[model samples]
Target chain A: MSDTILFDYWRSSASYRVRIVLNLKRIAYRAVPTDLLTRQQKAPDYVARNPQGLVPMLHIDGQDLTQSLAIIDYLDATRPEPRLIPADPVARAATLARAMVIIADIHPVNNLRMLHYLKNEMGQDQAAVDAWYRHWIAEGFAALELMAPENGLFGCDAPDLTDVCLVPQVANARRFELDMAPYPRLTRIDAALQAIPAFAAAHPERVKPA
Target chain B: MSDTILFDYWRSSASYRVRIVLNLKRIAYRAVPTDLLTRQQKAPDYVARNPQGLVPMLHIDGQDLTQSLAIIDYLDATRPEPRLIPADPVARAATLARAMVIIADIHPVNNLRMLHYLKNEMGQDQAAVDAWYRHWIAEGFAALELMAPENGLFGCDAPDLTDVCLVPQVANARRFELDMAPYPRLTRIDAALQAIPAFAAAHPERVKPA
Candidate 1:
């Protein structure tokens, strides 16, 4: 069978993760962009594949996969050579734990729509909204910084799952010009990640949509 | 190996998933409640196990497993008896996809603090905020309902991983008294799930955390 296709949007961090994983694994697949700006996600066809109308849905031989973490893990499971999750169960758990710090804990708190809600609906001033965004990043990063660096170079130098989730969030933080000075370890690990081609190549600007 | 200990708040939808899984597996776990109303999760020691200081930290064989999805999957893998995840590669992707729709899509957008911001800080009345809340749930549930009935009795059948993640969100939706009429299929599955002892016994009130 031929390779699977990925539905993506360049700027979406979730889509960015799938792109990074596909790149890291050296997988050949099509990247289809669903324009977020045009509100295409809310369109009938897009909602059929992903009810939530989110990007980064992977169609592997036709079955649609939602959720970046699930998609990433599925990629790892199907292509196990450069394992994204570590071998030891505990370390794997730790890696996932760190990922949760970013995915479940931090990213959810600072997603695009939430920020919009904070500004348009919550009447939060730009300053308060920015603070709110950074506050969550700082909180999760502090914990991740505390726990990461189990081995050598990157965070959880098994160079596993959590690190994949981390780099994008760090990039997003940088985009907002959130000061990373407070999160020493997270910044350290993120710096290490920046040196890797896999992370750099998968950046949003480099994606097919662009 | 001894059973994992789960520190959870009964009413916390995140914690409720683990309780359901443990029951499904017939795996024994002692439930420790972290007081949400009192903000006990913000306590120092709780912060140590979880840097994010969120409830539903699963202590398994001395390893503190945070993130409900991570914990649930670990059990699904290690135990493997009742297999919450589907076995075929494609089916497995679908299962993960369903779970992610609820976990990544719906829950994050409607979090406690997020809703609180709209209500208290943003000065949107409760009516507007509830509409905002149900809008997301309806968006997600509509997609889930369209899935093959074999996926669960609710969305897919017999309550696989997606259902485990889903039931709690539905519980929260009911708590908010969001109009459940729009998604009759979801309510049908909800009824199917509530009838099962495993899900019924794991309900928030069953946990007895005042």
Candidate 2:
């Protein structure tokens, strides 16, 4: 078995966050795509490993770890090189807060499953669903645009947890065709992150299966 | 000014998470209530301290910190007493994963703002809105029931981050009148957590304004 295996889907925001961290730290891991479109993630075998039946389950250190941020925390703890979070406690907290504005506040509400629920169960049409999707990203991005520091290309000169979260979410915003005009700073950061080989490698398009 | 101040609201699941952690750690700090109903959190002065206009912004160590989990991370890093997270990296990751199941997946979907949006924007009736609220909790609690461990009093021997998050969510579930019959393990854990003085004191009702 490889030292690490990431069960992922190309389009999952959570999965993308971990991929960015892994690439940024140069950790070698084999990717095993759990295609979300086909409900492969809901398979009995996959659920046995992660009770949540969620994608981006990382098998490492002889254990199966779920939750993207938690997996990133493990990687940062084990591989301290090119630290994903800042060394200063306050900065670390702020970075994490910035990350959660996406992870907790924005991403989950606009999750594929959520959109599906809105459509299938709640009888929301595509236009309504799309509006709901953009509404959240806009709400979150508005705050993040103001909160993000001008210290570096992203939140800081060096990519931290915030950028790991930002790039994937911005990708999703584009997928939904949410206007990027309101978030110039976020757009600039995304552009900067795209130039980095690590962030570039983790892009959904790069990981998508042919 | 006191070294520490917590801008909080009684019913916010995010704020409740931080209050539970503070009480559990016996950290002394003044609570400055920010009334969400009054939109006090969105006030210019409050927004200056926390751009997100969210409650449970902790002002400590000569800085203002947002996000409940981020604030808790700062506390766990600085205080390190009766540690809220496990010492081991893998264990910490699992605890955080369990916590995020509530933080990211469950809580945000059922937040007050979302409910308001459902009513005002979507024209959802009270019945429909309540159903929406309960639906997310049931979905999350079902998974959490299996993810939680068979350990002592709390999720583990001592209530860790998982329990801090779990108890508040269960409280919200109860308030929403969500059917709890399906999640026996979570119910048991919440009951056990309630006996802890810290958890008891942090209950929403206990913190309600006179």
What proportion of the true contacts does each candidate reproduce? 0.51, 0.78
Provide the clash count, candidate 2. Answer: 0
Candidate lDDT values, in order: 0.77, 0.88
lDDT of 2 at B111: 86
Model 1 Cα lDDT, one tens digit per residue, A70-120: 788778878976888765666666677678777777786687777776677
**Interface RMSD (Å) of candidate 1:** 2.3
How well is each residue in A121-207 modelled by candidate 2, as lDDT tens digits? 778899988999999999999999898766565556778888889999998899899999998888988888989999899888899
Q: Each model's TM-score, in the order given?
A: 0.91, 0.97
Q: The CA-based lDDT of model 1 is what? A: 0.77
Among incorrect, acceptable, medium and high, the docking class of model 1 is medium
Error of 1 at A136 (Å): 2.4
- Per-residue lDDT for B31-57 in model 1, tens only? 778887788888988888687778789
